[model samples]
Target: MGNSNDLRSKSLWMDIEVAPDARPLEGDQACDVIIAGSGIAGISTGYELALKGLAVMIVDRGRIAGGITARTTAHLAPLCDDLTSEMIKLRGEEISRAFYESQAAAVDRIEAVQKREAIDCDFRRLDGYLFQALNTDSKIIDDELDAVRKVGAPVHRLVGVPLAHCGNQHALRYPRQATFHPLKYLKGLAEIIEAKGGVFYSETIVREIEERKDGSVAAKTDSGVITAKAAVVATNSPIVDTLALHTKMAPYRTYAMAFAIKRGAIPDALYWDTLDPYHYVRLQPGEGAADTLIVGGADHKSGEADDADLRFEALEAWARNLIPAAKNVTHRWSGQVLDTIDYAGFIGRNPGSQNIYVHTGDSGQGMTHGVAGSLINSALILGDTAKWQEVYEPTRKTPSGIGNFVRENLTAVKNFAEYLAPGELKSLDDLKPGQGAVVRQGLSKIAAYRGKDGALHARSAACTHIGCHLHWNSFETCWDCPCHGSQFAVDGTALNAPAVSALADVKTGD
Candidate 1:
């Protein structure tokens, strides 16, 4: 809240600085593998490859581990967050079982890595509760129980969780699910990677990734180029593929808030509901006498909503009703997740590229997907075989998920049609300080923002990803593209990808 133009809000995990000594790339470089992002997936992949004695160079447009990973609630649940029942309907039982196995293995990999590296990031195994929301049908719990069991996960049918007003609620308890301080874990992992000869470059933007005819991949950045035997695009949204992968997934904006609570107020476990946009709750052990209760929900398609305050209010009301012991809010922020039509990450080789690989499509399970993708992509890069490869194949198609595919793609169609609609404001004069609006000007839609300092910043309302219309996200104070999850700063710099370039500036007669 200090400077809305800089950052709208800070996530609870942003306090930790990762790879503090890392510098931006200055010139041409070479490595066995070049990673385009430094999030959990990128760092974990680097750790895996570096352990094998491979020279790894990781780069990011921002600070290391400062992307969406820092904004996540750090839930390491391996079960399908979108509902295993629905996933089973889209993917067969065999594939669904493999998906679960891979996700669970991701959690296991985190446990193993933390132990091996002696990283103390509050890593612990806990029970996960998927209970029925108040007044909602209990059949979701039953169906999930059956579907999860079919996937060979250890789930127990139970009644009620350790929350108020949920004494008689039907629930499923999945043990061995995990949670952690993502920043701390990544910080330790980054140190370990560096210690093992892996290099990290923060504030390095990879503009284009190309697989050269010589069988090597080159990541072109503004500073220079990085050549490697292979490359991985771990950016939250893959910037390499324009249409194929983008069409298979949709972006969602999810909100989370943390509240102060007594250490023993609520059990240390993961809690989620059976609601469509399910509520997820967990506890983080604090240094002082008070612990932190983190609750998240109220998801909507990115760029489709600008009601984060209302969403936070809804979350607070729901949390207070269920856990009356929750105290004052400590931190509140939001992150974006890409939901795939098939409910699994797209990990492994990028389609049509031999030396280039991609890891994306978190599907609301970014933590697990990131670790699992690290393992899968690292193996594939090392010329080793991964058993779960087919489960997360980037090029694979789910014929059964056709309905979901159509439903999600319709968002783009509707978004494209918005280009013809009138802007939110007729002129920039209608904008007030600390506010932003799309203004119609001479047949062009301009994204206009009046800063708190009385300065006006204007750019094209069209997203550079595909020229789809951009919408102002008041909560995050950024422009969100409804088409493929590209986000731009108020000053027109692209924050998230599928779009690397900044928004085109509008010519204003001053």
Candidate 2:
């Protein structure tokens, strides 16, 4: 039997040893711009702002690039995850063109930075393919091709892919897309930012962001306060906004697994399918180690179901079915993606806050949207204009997405019914070591986990964010909120937001 003390969940992309480090905040620090996250959005924005000679400070609750950026497949595709066909249907032709152009420009910016800075992160320009499965309609392919062409994508129809068991006969091949090591790129950018006089602080959790009447913003963290002329909330979901941003976007948990493969077993290109929850694939040159093939998909709303292991299983099955040689599954991890109802990201000024900006709702295009957002935010903060500024303005409303907004919010509201339902376990005795369960105790639910020594640790089941009931996630070893996707560690320290506060500890006897 395997050791019960081991939970066995981690990101394969984060297996690298060397990374940039910074000290935690000690006292009140000041800068021209304070970024609350250190993922792609925060780092890229900080880097750009530093280049413009702005005194920038980036802070994160964890290590730099430790959040969702490390969880990305690192595919820098010209195509958007929400799909060009869907964007055309939701936002029409003009807005779709703008969205496509912005992502394309973002890819170009990444390539340019790699060249200009001489950063070595395995950045490569390769072809990308979006194909249809045997059961999917051919018209979907036609629709996507038409939409991408309208946006000036260098793509054409392909009769078939040159891979084993790819399951598709028709495809759209887009040239000049790219992929890279996300964390390595972040490290390069962080070093440059430091050289340019930007400051970075890790393990500094910001409790809240306050906008003063004097036109300055202060981020209240556990260590100290950080005052700045402007603040950027680049966290995957906005912890600062309770209702405005949360209601417009829904959080989804996507699973990815890296498989050990022989070199050249799979073609060195990015591949995606037209499945509802579509699969995305890329080949990573493992350097000295075994070449890795990364495949990601199996997305579902966060905390909606406690089936992470099942999702990983399905993903592996899909990969093995497509590529028989992908036999060894090396790593599996899940990351949250915020889906915007409007088919684009919100990357400009936050609503009702003049000095505060946000970059959220990336819709599974974090690598592209993160950098694109940084470019727009930096330009706007410098009192300049970006050509696509209006495209991602946070306050803009799209009538077309009203249906999605209503549907997603309705689902969130329905999630509240979990509070009234029966708990997953009748008593703490039902919990196994290294496992957690929600147990009902005298009209209240308690999130209970058993340690390896069989001692019980308990926390209030109510989410610190909204009062939705919390679910025990066995794979991640965390208490996850079904309503807004807030996650807490086994000991109840908040790990993710829309919940900044930790779950209240509960006395098992009291």
Best by TM-score: 1
TM-score per candidate, chains pooled = 0.98, 0.96
Candidate 2 wrongly placed segments (more than 4 Å) = 1-8, 17-19, 166-168, 288-290
Error of 2 at 463 (Å): 1.6
Over 1-510, each residue of candidate 2 has an lDDT whose tens digit, in order, gives 013213436787676522356878999999999999999999999989998999999988777777788888888975668788888888787888888888989999999998899988899999998888757787888988888988778898978886665445789999999999988788889988998889899877888998999999999987789999999999888878888888888888888999998887878999988898999899989867468999999998888778887888898888888888785888888888889897689998999999999999988999999999999999888889876877788888888899999988886677777668888887787888878888888888898889887888898988888777887777777777766678888777777777878788887872
Best by lDDT: 1
RMSD of each: 1.4, 2.6
Task: Spell out the clash pairs found in candidate 2.
Answer: none
* C-alpha lDDT of candidate 2 relative to the true structure: 0.84
